[model samples]
Target chain A: MIQAQSLTKRYGSKVAVDAIDFTIQPGTVTGLLGPNGAGKTTTMRMIVGLDRPDSGTVLVNGQRYQDLRAPLREVGVLLDAKAIHTGRSARNHLLAMAATHNIPTSRVDDVIELTGLTSVARKRVGGFSLGMGQRLGIAAALLGDPGILILDEPVNGLDPEGVLWVRKLMRHLAGEGRTVLLSSHLMSEMALTADHIIMLGRGRVIADAPVSEIIGQAGGATVRVRSPQATRLATLLAQAGVTVVNLEQDVLQISGITAAEIGDQAAAAGVALHELTSLTASLEDAYMSLTKNEVEYRTGGTGDDEFGDDDSDTTDAAADAAANDDPRETELQEAAR
Target chain B: MSTPTTLAAGTPETLADIGTEFVPASTPTGPHLNAIGIIRSEWIKLSTVRSTIWCFAVLLVVSMGLAAIMAFGLDLAGTDIATVPGTDQARFVAQASTFGVFFGQLIVAVLGVLVVTGEFTTGMIRSTLTAVPKRLPALWAKALVLFVTTFVAGLVSNIAAYAVTVAIANGQGLHASLFAPEVIFPVLGGALYLALVAVFALGIGTIVRSGAGSIAVALGVILLLPVVLQMIPATWATDVLPYLISSAGVSMFGLIQFAQVPLDWTVDLIIVLVWVIVSLGSAAVLLKRRDA
Candidate 1:
């Protein structure tokens, strides 16, 4: 288990990581989701003892990483894939790291085969492609077989087969009661791989929740009404205390109402609807809606004040308001009230 | 309760319970990277690189080639032996074993630079430090490797150059020191002198952390500053030049007539000390302070 309390890191005039606190529970894969320049790399570095924290402390298994009797056997990290010497072979790289903890050479060969680098184990790392390099980095991480595994961007350049292999690998590792903290920008990948998600933006923890809860709580219900009577249906829906946003001239986007309720309302009012569909957020939409304003980056010409803190997208706020009236979003609704 | 049984099985042992009940790591301690292991690692890295082998071979060829050429020319000239100033046997013969020091020192110094700088350029410093994060031990191991390799090679060059110089002098029917205080020290001193200078260069490589910067500074110290010092008045320039490691340090081995005003051997050793210890100390401190 890794616990970071009020962790912050600053480099010169720029703050790379703000006071972000989050815990990585054992026996699960905790995804650190963020865009580029979102302090994901810096925070990971601090946790591994590569960079010193200006403030706050990170504890691995109830002790600071630096104080661990044998750090390699407690926390294994793969910060950079190209950190190996070009002249040295892949086997030699793992050997040197293993030698630190007096780990056996047999274990070294086992990790080499586990990562599927046995064929090229004797080849120099200078000739490796990005995918091969990542494989080598994974091999290095598994060198000590530590309880906690921290990897930064483990799947940057992999074939489809390699990608599936990594997804299964992280899941398998976590299932064995190990703490797996992985950071990546790929939401779809995280959607499949992560058990819990901590979304970071502008160096702060903007959202932290379980994977199912993150998708469910971002928005409860919104109905897409497509009708020849779209305009007339919009006026009726507005009269019924439902907010309607015009998605297209023919399509009426109705929020604060269920799809079944909207269909029933339209039927009673004698409005002929061509199509009616409900939109409950995917993990992608939840991620975008949560990190819209705080994303730490924008190319340009996009309206900047994207965080309005309105609608059902504010999961905690929406979940809080539903407790008294809706009788849904349970477990959290009571605690929140 | 079931919890008490679980706690007894799971808790790690204290240091007092160390050999009798538990051995945490493969060794009782953590990592076991001593000076010997580090040196062995460095040697493996140094010898496997093709550049080290080529540079070492060049130093050998160039030094012997230069010595044989100079000895041949001096014999051909036949500059009358009766005149003490013209046919100084001590001065001419001693120059042979020491002639190649300058050219050989440059190549050896580059090897020294690469010893630390290659780790940075190739991104291997991260792995090197991760294994032995204490920092100074890596540099110490690098210095030891370079010092021994360069010194032993220097001794070989000295012996080879002596053989050529003796063969040429014998052909010309001239006598020289097969055993003399002046002759032995400089030949052996040339070996010691170049090796220490290379070790000093390796330290600078660590502190600068760039091959180009370290090499430039080393060259400026050895070659440029001495020449620049010449522009000063003769009295001041001469005094200061002899105190520098380049000028003062070399004279520890070089034989000059007793009448000549050169620093004593002890003074040269002191100058060498300042260069070696001071440079090495700064390298170690900067390494510990910075990120990997």
Candidate 2:
């Protein structure tokens, strides 16, 4: 468990990480989702002992990270892909990190193969592509087979196959009851990857709960009813204290009601219900809604919503759907191999 | 395998029958990430960087190269003049060996600049601090490794230059051996002075954390500031310059010190020590306070 108590970081007059308190549970993949400058990186840096918090403390396991004897083994952190020296081969880089913990050279080789960098392990990181550099970073992170893993934007440069491989890897690591805390602003990716989400908008966590629960709460359940008597049905739902929003000609979006409830209401009202569906908000929508007010660097406000990330959601969903096709994760590991 | 003891996260829940909720996060994991470990890691990292190797090689080349040419040139000029005052052909050749320490120190300063600056450039400083956690040990280890390596390397090169110069002078009919009474102090002092100055520069690099800033500051302290001080009417410059690491170190090479307050051998060593200690102390403090 990695716990940060009232962690705060300030650079001159600007506070980067404002006295935020959070904990990363074990045996779970907790996603730290936030905008570009929303203090996610600063919080991670403080937790891992890279940056000292001005007021507060971060504890890895029970003791502070600095107090840990075998920090690399206790908690592995992949701060960024470029953290390793570029001149050294991936193997040497891992070896050097391994040497810190007195871990054997064979373990370095094991992580190298684990991260699928065995083929390119001997290549200098300077020559490796961004994807390969990320792989090397993963390999280094796993060198100690640490109990907790902290990764900042771990899947940034991975290919589709590599991304799937990472998804499985995180799941597999979490399955083993290890703690994995990762940060990503990609809401769809977080939805697919994280079991729990901590949503940050500008250094403050707006929502912290199960990913599905957050999705349901922030973007309340909306019931879509298409009927010959849309206006009549809208009146009924509004009378029942549900806000009704009209979209197309005969469609009415009703909140605070379910599809089944709407069907019953329409049937009793003698409305010919051609179509009725409950559109629950996605994790992305929930995130955008909560962060809608606090996006520090808002591009524009005039659009339908600042985060009309439907395209990104579709792609990520498509990728997740494909990965989920084979219930047998064996295929993924095999394909990854 | 024993379960790794970590803090209970988020919503608290009872663990087992024991119900040991939050026991301040125990570390069944062994040794503390102590200062010594940080120092050891710093040593390995400093050694592995290619900048270290290249800079030392440059120090060797320039310092020894100066000795070789100076010895040959001085010996060749002494055909008519058998002896010149307190300086003879042999003495001049021995003295020739020590001139390069000044230039050699500058290159070492550049080497020191790269040591800390390279970490910033590559963003490895974050990783380093994460490993060590308490940032002071990292700085201390750097100063320890850099001072030792730069010092030893500087010393070896200086001696090698002296030996090679003696050989060249012998060939030119002016024999001066490394074992001579007057030979060891000047040559060894030259080497020690360069190494100490490099360490002084390294501390500056650690505090500044910039390649350009560190080298500029170090060079200015040694070379430029002294000139400015000398321009003043007060003879304080004469007293102050000798106590400066560079000046005191250089005086160790010359037979008759020109500076009014020429530091004795003990005073020169103390001055060098002061520069290293004070600069490194500032660096250590700065490192502890700053974010990685």
Candidate 3:
């Protein structure tokens, strides 16, 4: 278990991680979600004691990281894939790290095999690709078999197969009652892997809850309606707490009302309907809306309205389609197949 | 706990359903962080790198080669070579054996800087600091390993140089006992000075935390400071020259006298030691207080 209280860090005048408190428990995977430069990496660095907190304390397994008897045995951290020396081979790098804690060579070989890096363990790290380097970093983190594991961007450059392997590995580790905290900007991956998520925005905690709760709270269910009388149907469905948008000629996107209610109202109003489908928002859509104001680097006001306004139909429709093309939908389709 | 244990052990089919690839990670059982383990880790780090090997090889070759040339190129035509005093002959051979240390000091300085700066430049320092979070132990282990290894290498090179000098000078009627005080003391002292110079450079490397910048600062203090001081042509400059690191270091081995009044070798060694202490002390402070 790891506990932090009022943890704060600043680089000069700019605060990198504002005062935040969190507790990561064992037996589950906790994903730290954030945009670029949102202090996710800084918070992880502080947990491992690589960066000093200006105002608070972080305890790993009930002790400060520096004061632990054997820090590697208590917590394993993969801060970045480039933390290894380029001149050394993967095996030698692990061996040297193992020597510091008196860990044996057999354990090093075991981790090398566990991470599926035995084929390239003898090669210099300078020549490894980004994915290979990430595997090596994971191998190093698993060298000690610690009670807690913290990885920053573990699946950053991984292939689809590699991404699946990491998801299974994280679940397996947590199943064994180990505390696992991983940071990522990919909400779809987190939606599949993490049991809980803590979202950060501009050095502050924006939301912390279970994955299902966060998604449910961020987005209300919306329904897509198709009819020949699109204008009449939109006017009929418009009411208090309800939003209707004319998506092209025959479709209307309605929110704050269920599809059955829309269908019944259309039938009672003597309007013919071609299609009515309920659209449940994916985690990606929820993340976009939750962090829309917290983004540090906005691109040309493109992210101003995630649901798109009525003025720009083509661009907004394209953005909305892109947001809905999430991996959870693909997984659902595959399960159905 | 009892229910989960029963579920895990009761059904083989359930276990197989989770996939056979999910092997349980074995618990790590080992001793905690200790001085011996850290020192051993540092030794492995030093020996595995190519730069250390290259630097040590160059040091050995330069020492032996310079001794050979000095022994063969001595001018003995104007004097009766056989009639020279036995003590003076031993001093000549000892001087030749240790002359290469003058150049070897610069080589080890560069080696020392690279040992720490290589980690900094490659981002390996973060991994190292994370492993030993107290931070100072890593620096201490590195210094101890570098000092001991450099000392052994320096001793070997000086002895090899002495052997080459004896072999060549012996044919020319110059005979000196290897165990003689004049010959042995300077040989041992030269090795000591070389080892100290490497440690001094290691401290500078930690402070600067950059390869090129640390090398420039270390070499400037060791090589250029004395020259610049000598060119001042003042009495205070003359007095301060003896206290400079390179001047005192070379004087410690009796290789050269920087002061007009030549002080004792022990005093020169102390002067060199003070410089090393100051450099390492400040380095430790900065390393401990700064974020990795």
Candidate 4:
């Protein structure tokens, strides 16, 4: 478990990470989400004792990182993928780190094979591509098999297969009752992988909740209905608090209601339903809403409307198509089909 | 792109299967992280880099190779020491044999600076500090490893140079005893001087934390500042010049004394040590207080 209490950091006049408190419990994967320059990296660095906090304390398993008798065995950290001497080969790099903890060489080879870097383990790191470098970084993080893993942007440069592998690996690690905290700007990946997420904006935690709760809170679940009598269903679904958007002559997107409720109402009205599917607001939509005002660098006159003006039909169609393309939403669609 | 059969066959069904076999059946009982482990880790880090190997190789060749050339040059000159007044034959021979110290010390100094600054330049310091989070142990380990390696290399190079110089000088009838105080002191002292020069540079590297900046500062202090200090036409300037790093190094290595001002070798060693202590002390403070 990692606990950060009132952790704060500042450089000159700029406050990088404001006083923030968070508790990352074991047996779960927690995603730290933020825009560029939102202090996610700084917070992770503070936890590993790489950066001194202006005011606050971070403890890993109830002890400061520096005070741990066997740091690598307790907390594994990968702050930067390229933070290695490129002159050394992958095996030698892991060997040097393992030597500090008196970890045997066999374990080094284990991490090499586990990360699927066995082919190039003997090659110098300077020749590694970005994806290979990230793999090597993960290999190093797993050298000692620490209980707490802190990775900053683990999926920054990974192939689709590698991305899927990391998702499985993180879930596997958390399933083993270990604490995993990773930071990423890829909202779709986080939405699919993270059990819980901590959202940061302008050096503060803007929102913190479970994945389902965050998506639910952004804009509650909406149902997409396709019925032969869609026009009548739209009229019937339009109520005091429900919003029904007519996409096509026979398709209606209804929000502020559940899919079961819509189905029941359509059946009662004698409307033949062709398609009725529930859609959760994409994490991108939820994140944009939570941090639209908190973005540090904004082009002027954008007016904080991520999906353009509400009255523009072109933009509304575009937003709907984009939301439907989300991997999680697509998975839901596939499961429904 | 065939997957390794171990992982390809679904052997690692869970996180427990991933690295469980790699873990020792029984954790080593006593403290795994100690000074010795740190020293070993530092030795691996220092030896694994090609640049470090190249630097040491250059130090050995330049020091010993240049000494041989100087000895031959002196033999060709055929200086008659008996007729020349105020000529100490042993001191002259020792100086000629270790003339390469001037060039060799620069290489050692550069090696010292690169020992620490290289990590910072390549961003390896993050991985290093993450392993040893107390921070001081890493610094101390680097210092220890650099000191031992440079000291041994210096000793071997100086001895080889002395042997070659003596052999070349013997053909010209200038005899020098290896056991003679004058001959032995300078040979060993030259090695000591090189080692200390390296440690001083390591301290500078720690404080500067930049390869170019540290090297420039080290060279400026060891070479430039002394020359700049000499231009001042004052007694204090002349007195202080001998106390500078280069002058003290020369004196400690048993080179010709500064005619106007002479300091005991012990005093020179003390002065050189003060430079190391001040540089390393400040580096330790900043390293602990500042963000990586």
Which number leads on DockQ?
A: 3
Per-residue CA lDDT of model 4 for B58-136, tens digit only, reads 8878877887888888743555745543335566567766777788778988999998888898888999999999999
Per-candidate iRMSD: 6.0, 4.8, 5.3, 7.0
Please tell me the interface RMSD, in Å, for model 2.
Answer: 4.8
Which pairs of residues have clashing backbones in candidate 4? none
Quote the chain B TM-score of every prediction: 0.82, 0.82, 0.89, 0.84
Once fitted onto the true fold, the runs of candidate 4 whose alpha carbons sit more than 4 angstroms away are A238-242, A264-270, A296-337, B1-32, B75-93, B259-261
Per-candidate interface DockQ score: 0.21, 0.23, 0.34, 0.31
Each prediction's number of clashing residue pairs: 0, 2, 0, 0
User: What is the C-alpha lDDT profile of model 1 across B1-292, one tens digit per residue?
Assistant: 0111111233354323322232222222544445566666677666656667876788788778777987887744655565544235755766886788867777777777777787888777866765565667778887888898888888788778777887877677655674665566778888888888888888888888888998898777877787788777777776677766677656777733211476677778788878888888898888877766
lDDT of 2: 0.73
lDDT of 2 by residue, A105-161 (tens): 888888988888888987777888888988888887787678788889989888989
Which one is best on lDDT? 3
lDDT tens digits, residue span A13-49, model 4: 9899988887676778999997888899999999989
Task: Point out the worst 10-residue segment of candidate 3 chain A by lDDT.
Answer: A308-317
Better of 1 and 4 by lDDT: 4
For each prediction in turn, the share of the native Cα contacts (below 8 Å between chains A and B) that it retains comes to 0.22, 0.27, 0.56, 0.52
Per-residue accuracy of model 3 over B213-287 as CA lDDT, tens digit each = 999999999999999999998899999999998898888777899899997999999998999999988999999
Alpha carbon deviation, residue A166, candidate 4 (Å): 1.4
